[model samples]
Target: MAQSYATDLLHLIQGPPGTGKTLMLAHLAQLLAQDGLRVFVTALTHRAIHNALNKIPQVDANLPVCKIGEERLTGDLNVPNFETFDQSHFAEKSGGDVVGATPFALQSQRLANVEFDVVLFDEVSQITLPLAIMGMLAGSKYIFIGDENQLPPVTTFSETEAAQTSIFAYLAGRGQETMLNITYRLNDVLTDWPSRTFYKGELKASDEAASRRLNLSPEATRWDFVLDPDSPAVFLDLCHTNTTVRSRIEAEVVSELVLSLLMRDVAPQEIGVVVPYRAQSRLIRSLLRRILMDDEVNKKLVVDTVERMQGQEREVILVSFATASQKFAAQMADFLFQPQRLNVAVTRPRSKLILVGSHHMLKADEIVPEHKETMDMLRDLDRQLPDHHPAQRGYQRVKATRKQIANYYRLLISIMLK
Candidate 1:
């Protein structure tokens, strides 16, 4: 990896999700610094840039790194960007080991004289070609780290203003890219459908043996939140509503399952709630708040749209696919049809994944022909239902173990009596 600097003028690292791209970036920066080269690491957003910077050790300890742009949302790191800092403050450490910033920050007049030996771009697919070109001008050589299959640059408004392909995508087509082969996030069972459907069966799990089967813990294996202990990926076939109001049934079921996990000694922070739309996230959050009164529990229970859940992971993930009804399928299809969105949602769970939505909507040809991959993946999950689970053609059972069953009814009875 360190030899990338001497190998090519422009190198592309095309890695799939959970392929340790960020960790690779950090190590590359360290190697470049060790070789006495000036390096700059960048991404499109402040959060992304900050994340890359956070991977490096303290500047004083090893590399002298500066972060530029808006203050980080978390304020976890106090390092200011070159453009934000006083000219003299940056000048002191200006020629130091490495720097992290957004492309816009690199264009600043303050950094015009600050040349870099190598520029590393994280999430390069999110960067447009023009911005990438401008950033490249500051360095003699460059490296791009991104997964085009996961999410492409957001260029809805600049359809005609800018070319659709990212710089990474453009270079990759010419065969100037290296693929990161190992994936640390998913086991083989969870990765099978995505591999064949998205990457044409090219994606490989880091653990060949573990990838061969779903490795649920003893508690999770017996946890009947859904049927089939061997199935890490599941589809909970709920009725999708056409109204603007959220699906109450989905919300109730999510609540019950989340509570069940909590009752079973699962940490709240290890669980996540993924929904297709912002409206559904809001409704689910509200429902969770009412049931989980503790602020800590509410804070740890992440209920958000899939876009927001990207670059994040949890031990357990519950996805809410609220798109149902033929009339609403058009609107819902707009949000759910994209293969990238589904990829992001499905891959975020490390241990277990549960998808809740109407199976009819998932398999409907009338919804959107372009979304066949998304539909196919959903159907593959639905096919995992065993005969013993028992449901209609389109409806799959959400199973729970004996203990969960006992606690569920016990809680229900207590509430009724109260």
Candidate 2:
């Protein structure tokens, strides 16, 4: 589909995470340029623009790519070529076969005279309808590449405002939409549940990906509890009240898990710690620092929220589902459980995904039938998974003493105060 030059006019590429969408964008632009067509590429942010251009080999010889923006804004890239919309040289350099910029940059008056035969929008799901239409004005045809199932554009306007839809979502029904089905980043065991739960079982793990092994040696199994064949994803059901979404016991467990991985020779760079809330991320970071103490280990591991781990991947991912409880299940069910957020969180791991949360909290009876897909997946996984918990139970639950609870509370307060 990347090399196809069909007459459909508008092309939609539904590239899920780990499908190499950025690489395809660069190669498609090269194909269009070689066909003697003027091509232009733009994304929602400068970092995305840099990411696409960085993937093109011998960028200067293969494509007449020019970065369009202010020198200060695009200076960090250190590209061989650049053009500013406000500069005098823009008129001459802008006529190149391909130009890269943001939607706002393309709105410049200097580009009013320029036109493109094809314009490619990367991450089109994040581009608002107005901004997407603004880009189409300068191009006769276009290609949109993104995952509408992921995050959408941040729009201040309501849905009542003239048909609320992102460019990618709007064209999904009207144009040719292609979904990339094979993922190269996740292992076979890691891909099955997510594919059936989130993507309607259309996604499959590539043969090469299924055969891929972790960087750790075979002896590392002693510390890697997730290596069990029956259960690649472990759910630790900890008991907690809904009063605080943050969990001290969760932090303690995650910290211990990270330390074990470190001791087992798993490089810190290969592990990622993700929490549902910012407070949990902060708390876990503090606990990890206290557990590791070494500056090098601290530099390698990542602790963040699900929102921040959108396009990132790690060999092993540990998720903290903060604020899970049965008493407040009805009140907090809708607020805490989001299908897309859960999809993003679980799919970030290549080999293993360990989720730590309250099973009762996650499987709250208050959750509407429609919104229980993620929790259902977890429940199904838990049932099929053999009892691999070290404690001889199917899952582990945190049992904190009165003093330990007090210390955990104080630690949270101290971190907040700092």
Worst 10 residues of 2 by lDDT: 388-397
For candidate 1, the per-residue lDDT at 95 reads 41
Q: List the residue pairs that clash in candidate 1.
A: 67-81, 68-81, 188-211, 224-399, 224-400, 224-401, 225-399, 225-400, 226-399
Clashes of 2: 0
For candidate 2, lDDT tens digit of each residue in 1-418?
6433574478889887677777778778777777777777888777667777666544346566667776667644545445554353534543336677787776775464677889889878778788898888888888888887665665554322322467877888764878888888887666766677767888888988765545555454222444332345667555566635688778876776676677667789989998877888888888777666678889889998876687778988998877666556545554465555666787888776777766667556545555466456556655534343343222222333465446546654554466
In candidate 2, which residue pairs clash?
A: none
Error of 1 at 356 (Å): 0.9
lDDT of 2: 0.69
Cα lDDT of model 1 by residue, 1-418, tens digit: 7446566697888878778888888888887887778888887776677777777774235676777555434365545454453442645553447777667766675465667889999888678888898889889888899877676677654322333567766777766678886678876566666676777788877774233332334564223647333566677765454533357667767777787677666688988998877888888888677777679998988888876777788877898776666556554654565667778888887767888766556545555576565566656656754452233222244533445546655764564455
Q: Please report, in order, the local distance difference test score of every candidate based on alpha carbons.
A: 0.69, 0.69
Regions of candidate 1 where Cα sits further than 4 Å from its true position: 58-61, 72-90, 93-96, 109-112, 157-163, 208-223, 227-229, 243-245, 367-374, 384-418
Q: Provide the lDDT at 110 for model 1.
A: 49
